[model samples]
Target: MDEQRPAHILVVDDDREIRELVGDYLERNGFRVSHAGDGRQMNAVLATRAPVDLIVLDLMLPGEDGLSIFRRLRAESRSPVPVLMLTARSDDVDRIIGLELGADDYLAKPFVPRELVARIRAVLRRVRMLPPSALAESAVRTIRFGDWRLDLLQRNLIDRGGVVTPLGGAEYGLLRLFLDHPQHIFSRDQLLAQLARREFEIEDRSIDLRVSRLRRRLGDHARDPRYIRTVRNEGYVFAQPVSYEA
Candidate 1:
């Protein structure tokens, strides 16, 4: 058996104090940490340092805000790197945008160090838990539900017309969880656990937001969802039968 390595983390923030504080904390908690002040510096670190398992990105930066940097990062990198966004704002606009843009998680400023550590671990664990078959190419190539087809190998959705819509990491995870157990009702708490989200995330409506995004991708309306239906106060259910394709 091979020895598992500690997760390497990149802290991208303009504030020196914050970068150092977070880097020190992560290092203390058995992670390898690298610091970057701006997008340029972040790119430099990414180019020079060892492969990073996750990134702690601050929304507010001196040049090229975190969102733009994230967009560029996603466009340039072949493999996706999980990002946990840090926002000082109280509003959900930036957080929602980050989520829609495929951020792995988000944290507001004035956050406890322990919570940050916990969220990082949760995100990395989700990435690490991908089955060997999923990591490579699985025997099951795609799953069909209704008019849409989910490409398991590429982690994207294809419509009847062959339009491919890419899903974020969180969206892919949630959709896979639902598809794996059709007709099974999953409460918010249950969804949180299955998605590896901390209890603290429920207050922020994380599950609801993710589900809404998925529904939009599937062209399923919340009021009259054809595939995913809400069960009043209980939770949501994937009401469609799924077929596997090789």
Candidate 2:
């Protein structure tokens, strides 16, 4: 029997020393690592090389910044390759923006290499264990709530008028969980445990941010949310009735 191949990761950063350090560390941990200096190089490598399981993208790049690259990747790529963002310690705005833009996770600069590895593993595990509906090839499974339709196979949100809205990995995961368990109130800790597979210091605010983004995509007002409603002193609940079709 052929041995299973190690997961391949692409590290995209303009910082040469940091890239090499991360690449070597990941390689030492039994992952196949590739390096790219900038967005251009990153795109080139992705186009010609074998499929990458995850991407470690730095927020700061020489020419095209990481956010722009991430947006373009989400818009263009058919594959939902998970992305882990690297940002400076002070880049709070960038970090939130990265999450809103669909990054699976992120680490601030000056982080432990081991932590990065753990995050990578967690993301891969979550992706691998996605719902069977998401993995089905012959048929598309979708959950309809309100006027929105979530295509599990395509990982996109469509409206009554058939407008497609792309969702980030975290956003999609959270939304999927909510749709699967509509009208159920999920506490912050429960949500973190359910959605984020890896052990990380995820703040309650992070979950709030993701929910906020999802609400925006669903066009649900926070104050008078028709879909997701916040329970006082508790957690959020998906108030709308949900129906699934395969």
lDDT of 1 by residue, 106-127 (tens): 7889899999998887667556
Best by lDDT: 2
What's model 2's TM-score? 0.58
lDDT, candidate 2, 174-221, per-residue tens = 888787556556667667766754233346679998889888988887
Measured against the true structure, the TM-scores of the candidates, in listed sequence, are 0.58, 0.58
Model 2 whole-model lDDT (C-alpha atoms): 0.80
The segments of candidate 1 whose C-alpha lies over 4 angstroms from its true place after superposition are 1-3, 131-246
List residue ranges in candidate 2 displaced over 4 A.
Answer: 1-3, 131-246
Clashing residue pairs in candidate 1 are: none
Model 1 weakest lDDT span, ten residues long: 195-204
RMSD of each: 10.9, 11.5
Clashing pairs in 2: 102-168
